[model samples]
Target chain A: MDFFIQLFTDPVAFWNSHTLLIAQIGINSIIASSMFIVLYSGQLSLAAPGFMAIGAYTSVLMDLHWHTPLALNLAAGVVLAGVVGVLVGLPVLRLRGVFLAIATIGFIEALRLGVILNLPITGEGLGLKNPTADPLGGINMVLVSLAVVLFIMWRLTKGRLGAAWAAIRQDELAALSQGIDVARYKMIAFVLSAILAGFAGGLEAHLNFFVDPGDQQYGVTRAVQILTFAVLGGSGHFLGPVVGALVVTTLPWVFQQAHDYINIVTGVFLIAVIVFRPQGIVGRGGLAIVRPAWWPRRARVSAPSPG
Target chain B: MDQQLLNAIFIGSIYALFAVGYTLVFGVLDILNLAHSAVFMFGAAITYSMVVNHGLPFWVACIVGIAACAVMGLVIEHVCLRPLRRRRAPPIAALISTVGLALIIVAAIEQGQTGSLFAWLWVDGPNSVAFPAGTIPNPTWHVGDLTLEASKVAIIPISIALMLVLGYVIRYTQVGRGLRAVAENPRAARLMGLDVDRMISLTLVISSALGGLAGILFGVALSDISPYIGRDNVEVRGLAVIVLGGMGSIPGAVIGGYLLGLIEVLALVVLGSNARGGVAFAALFLMLVLRPQGLFGAQLRERI
Candidate 1:
């Protein structure tokens, strides 16, 4: 396709023309990282969009009412999002698996339909206008912030906290037996994820120059998109979701000709990836999943252990 | 209040039809079939096409629609579920796949109806389709101050009859025994010589059929249908019903459906319709937090 040819032949031009695309990728990558934390802790919490909305509205409201500095506003947004995450996580963390997923979905819909759509300050679903929005200028900030967040996440995963999270993910009962405090570690991961989503939301609102509380903006649809990032990329490693975000965001541009059929392709691709590579695109090792677990371990395997 | 109660029962019965199918699948497989909503929408569309376009009798249309839903269910189980089941994948994998399947089916429906790029693949599609005429009539019955639509009485009885039949089958039939056995413990059922696979397939067929019935009845109630109606109209409310009824309990589903129906209607009266939608979900959230077992279900014990 010409799109591919243009990208490869004129890299600089591609970058220049696709500045918005690059920035969007950066924002989505941050949100993907936010998704990674909750999944890493074995919590299937679909509460990222809810937190993102909180962050976006909080920062914008601050700017509108008190004319706070951007730094202060963003910080307040992130912290408040984390605090609300804690409050929401406390009651919700009791549930696991599908129950947790549905509950979080309920949280998102209730927040959007009840609070965001009803409140006049949010323009009652008509959306908000950000006069001080820096649409073209925030790309640098997004890139920098994404870098910092990824580095922090990578470093965090290499620590004892990360070890505890892995243990919990592997088996919650086993984690509790080891005195790892399952609830606390899950809450920490959830709150950290909320903070990342909040930060991403604030940055995204700035770039868009509006805080539209649309269904697709802060609803189940966005939650599903964020989930796809982690699933398609492979949730095992930090890099998986980042790559997932990159690929998923760019796919539309790449497949411009199949715009109408794009949803069908994405759907089929999602199903294929899930069926073929349950571990993900960036998961550990190669495509050969002929491990001992596939068959019964020690089920008369004449050879040595596969691992 | 009597009139309002009649209204709630009518609405709730339709929701219960969809909800029970949802819960039935969940009960046996322990995975949410996200495509069930699409199946529900498909049912409505199929019924519309049969009676309106094909000029079939209403009863014939209902049979065709229900049969088609069963086939769709079987396809979903085989395509989306069987592979994952064999691999012993997590529950979320199945959920994601179903969501993906939902998108494809819904998109196909849209393309088919609109006669987009592939005209050959077209079926009824994206826009709102009016319910076929001469199927059901709406007539009010009055006795003193109490007045109610005749269709409401009929609709509520249909739901109750379906629920009663389902409960009886699960309690009495040979296939029902196999279903319960599998639901209780698949491995144990397999060891006991029960056909787990066959039972699961049957569950899908029966459940999908319920969804078909719900879709047609809902079309009659609303007098029209849309492709996008699944998410907001049936899926969410069906979920609320199952959760409220106690996830796997059949009777719980019935009571929960009517209960939520009453709550929605009364809440509309008190808070107005604008806030009513949120109030229902907010109630579901609060209920989960307060009584995660739902109103009638057993206490949840954490499984290792």
Candidate 2:
């Protein structure tokens, strides 16, 4: 209760005191926005976490080995993740919907358990310490990168590419009939989404002093968390996931009293959202609900459609 | 070689038990019931509670656990699935809804332990108890240069019996026919005077019961109960099984279950336990890429 009250009452104080939380929220929003791209194109690819893992590990390892500036390491991380995304996407994209989801999960688990756990370069899963971690320096970078990603997403969605994506998402056969390359457009979205997730991952690793390769860090759990942001925020619009990231990242602070039951609460809320507002918290028409028949009519301004 | 084969068949039967239920839900409903595993965990939890906390007989506890799972299945269908189905929501909506249901159930079971440590300690902790093997006799079978724990060998025939029973019911019973009809075309089934809702509900009950039975078998065979056991092992392997067997194919699920079991165990022996899980999924990844239709699945006409 006080958490919410404090935020509402002392906005500046809250922002100053919760800089880390704010930065984390910004990073999650970037990941969520990236998820929004894949979902926008009707793909159920849950490979964000895997890409995040790739980005985090690549950047952190480069930093540890060469003492490269953070920008170079982060860039390499994003590029490598995108490359892997393409490589993985080519074969697995043949399966649709839930099958695709499961296959991607397989990809992530194999990567985490088979490669990461076994590889000595990843510190053999004991995790690596980040000596030059800037706990405070990252906030500006996160906020600025988030702005750039959002701008790019907004412009992309408004362009011909976004139209192609929308058509593919709506109906692939129809999209193909219209001469839109369904496979190519999907690959583009998948790759773009990977790039965004990778960027988020690199930024996240930069925020902390340690890079942990635990399953929780880059496994099915993280995948679900990414999915939750899109689902709760409403995947129909770009803004939906951004808002979702904000609310979900802040929920524990908001419902401080029920922190222990946060998972159940989030689960219930997600289920309820799907049931009641299948479009999500933000819909095409800006929020939707089925009002009971007993609710007052719109002042009976019009009863003339039949006539 | 014989010992490895025996080990494979033993674990294969148990994997078949869990995979069959998972496949059944997917076959009929055409959506993954991610909470199927949570129901599996609940069965073990209930059995553990009854045996250790209440001191009930093992058989009695198993029966009660199965019954409770059946009820829990109905609740999931009602709470998580029915609303979305009625609204004619997208398939992914149903998928995500099931995930949400899984999350809630797992949280409730784990006592809100999100992203916790490795599962060994959690399962054998003070809260849950090991299955009492005394309730089912422990014996051994021996041959030249080979010995098999009766508990393990029993899984093959026991699972075979259960599969036979399931096959018979699906082939011969009225309710089974209704389920198949609905699976083929829900609207058509409804037009044909079939109660589609009732059939779906009944299917959930049966699927959940199978999951519960599988959990109990795991408890008896492994002699331990842990909430993590269901989602961790079942989620990945059950998925690989369904895909390998051919989606919506019962025989495919069973065969794929055993095949995957063989592959996992053999992979463990060859690659070491740490890399064994990756081997199964690597197999799945390859199978999906090369043969998306699976061994027995109908040829897929579309690609994502």
Candidate 3:
């Protein structure tokens, strides 16, 4: 309650004090958007964190060794992520649904445990320190990047590309029958998602003092959290996932009174929301509670027939 | 080398037991019960609490723990999976809801410190503690160049015998026939006078029971029990095991578990301990890409 009260009462102060939280929201929204892309394209690819890792490591390594500007570092990270995306996407895109999800999980765990944790340059388990981090000052960049990413996502969804994606999502065989190159469009969505995730990773790296290689950072847990954002937000619209990111990231703050039992509240909240709004918070229908089949209903009175 | 081989066989039994439940649910309902791992931890937690907090004997505690897990299975079906199924939501929605349930279960156990709301359930909070040394009878046996403890050796026979019993029940029982019919086609099974929902509920019961038993064995054998044993040890690795054997094939999951245990031990022996976790996932990736059907899975179908 205080969180919202302050936000409404003193807007400038809220922005000043809660800059890091806002920045994190921005980063999560971007990652959620990346998840939104793959989900929109009928692919359940969970390789976002893997690409994010690639982006984070590449950019942070460049900054540490070459002392390059942030823009060049981010660009290099994005490009390398894209290239790896193409390579990984080629073989993985053949698989569908849960298989794709599992394969991607395999990819991420293999990357984190196999590559990142082993390489000395990555600082291995200890993680690399980012001396150039600007936790407070990086807000503008994060917000701007989020806005740009959201805009691109909106435009892409409205164009021919989005239509192809929608077609593929509805029915792959039917879409193929209509002459839509199903494979190419899926690959495009996947690669685009990877690039966005990578970019978000680069920006996120700038917000922190250390580039930690923890499981919560770049592992299946992070992947699942990103998936939750897209899922809970409603994958139907571009803004749904952003809303999800906002709600989920701020859940801790909102339920602060719960203290030690916050997770219990959170769990109940997630179950209730998903059970009532399976289509997502921003889906087609207006605000309405989806009553289960067995719920009691009011009986209707019989009306007299007109003579 | 011989000791590692023996270790592989021992651990493989646990993997097979855990995966059997995972694959059973996936095979029947076609939903990955993410809460399954939580139940695995819960079973161990309950048994530990029963013995330590309540002062019950070890065998009685184990039985009570397994029974509690079976009840947890019903909770999962009624609370998480049922409503989503009623709504006809996508599989991913079920994933999220199950994750929600998992969070609740883990938190409940983690917050079970002294004087806390859940102190009655678990008093150790988030810390890892083992069963008291004398809680269960453990005798040591030594073979030429090999050492074995009865506690560890006990896991092998128990897991195998239980798995074989599960296989028999699934293969040659009236309840098994109902389960298979439902797995084959729920609507058809319903039309044929079999209660589909009941079968699903039964599936959860059996699956959760097995999962609980496996957890009890794991906690005893490894001498490590905590709120996170399931999440950290077998949650993801269970997926790898099922995927390796073939998703939904019982025999496959059994083989796949042993195969995974062997592979991990081999990786540990050859590439050192750091590579152990990595090699397993790398194997999972290659398996899905190169042979998505897995060893025992039929030709790929577009279920998901």
Best candidate (score: TM-score): 3
* Alpha-carbon TM-score of each model against the true structure: 0.92, 0.92, 0.98
**Comparing to the true complex, what docking class would candidate 3 get?**
high
Evaluate model 2 with DockQ and give the value.
0.48
Q: How good is model 2 by TM-score?
A: 0.92
RMSD of each candidate relative to the true structure: 3.9, 4.1, 1.6
Ranking by DockQ: 3, 1, 2
Whichever of 1 and 3 has more lDDT, that candidate is: 3
Residue-wise lDDT of candidate 1 within A1-307, one digit each (tens)? 7778989999989888899999999999999999999999898988999999998998899999999988888999899999989999999999988788888888987888888888898887688888998877888999999999989989888999889999999999999999999989999999999999999988888888788887678887789888988878888899889988998888778778877778788788778777776777888666655232234566565888699
Model 1 chain B: which ten-residue window has the lowest total lDDT? B295-304
User: DockQ of each candidate's interface versus the true one?
Assistant: 0.52, 0.48, 0.81
* Pairwise DockQ winner, candidates 2 and 3: 3
Highest DockQ scorer = 3
lDDT of 1 by residue, B11-97 (tens): 889888888899889989999898898888878777777777677887898898889899988988887787788778778778778
**Model 2, position B67: C-alpha lDDT score:** 97
Give the distance in Å from residue B281's predicted Cα in candidate 1 to where it truly belongs.
Answer: 1.3
